[model samples]
Target: MPVFSCADAIGGGTEPNGSEVVAVRVGQHDGYDRLVIEFNGPIPAYSVTGRSGTSFTTSPKGQTVTLGGTNGVLIVMHSIVNWTSYLGPYAFEPNFPVLREARQIENFEGYQQWALGIQGSPCLRVTTLTSPSRLVVDMAATR
Candidate 1:
């Protein structure tokens, strides 16, 4: 059995000067829903913070972005560049049991942001993976 914490999850110290977010993937698991951010280079410094509402404002632009759910999580990656390389969907409503939606908030000025809409307040577990360099976030299923 794996242990997950509701506390903020943070990792990586590398500066993604040449890296780009290649894709974003999500999956439904037995006890959690997983969100993955694929990168073309080394994974960048990132943080995951849980929030109370689904409404979030975009960085640098101040545009309001709302998602479908009672609670949400914010994902931020630093030192990232070249957002044009990511051709994947900017927003998706997976409608998973816990993870309801995933959307891109911003990709400007060496910073990247994403939001995950969740059904209820849930714990989060974040991990950095190699080989292809990816960041994984798991949200525990709400009862």
Candidate 2:
């Protein structure tokens, strides 16, 4: 198993060109609230950083995005292709114990951006899985 931390997690697959994001899902686990980003191809280069503000603005457009909780985390991925293939909602409010909401704020050019609203400060464990080719972000649930 990979280690978890409150610091930023950076790194992803070696898909030289680009990949399509097929699905995004959220679930509650025993010790963490999980957010899964499923891709049609290899996972793209990405970085997960905890944002300082609760409110965030969209890229390029500069429009404000509203999230449900007090803290936020920004996920930026490179070499993301075919945004039209992602049929899931661009925004959702799951309201889990730690992860409160999420929104795909940007999908322009070859870049994709997502914002997550969370409660408290949870440690993050980012893992890349095969067979399905997805990125799993696990936020530790507070007691």
Candidate 2's displacement at residue 104, Å, is 0.6
The local distance difference test score of each candidate is 0.87, 0.84
**1-143: candidate 1 lDDT, tens digit per residue:** 34778788878766555788988999999989999998888888889999999999987889998898889999999988776667778888999988999999888778889999999885888888888999999998954
**TM-score for model 2?**
0.92
| Tens digit per residue, CA lDDT, model 2, 1-143 | 88778899889865645679888988999988988998878889999998665688898799997788878888889888776667767887899988999999888877888899998785789999987899899888863
Lowest lDDT 10-mer window, candidate 1? Answer: 10-19
RMSD of each: 1.6, 1.6
Worst 10-residue lDDT window, candidate 2: 10-19
- Clashes, model 1: 0
**TM-scores of the models, in the order given:** 0.92, 0.92
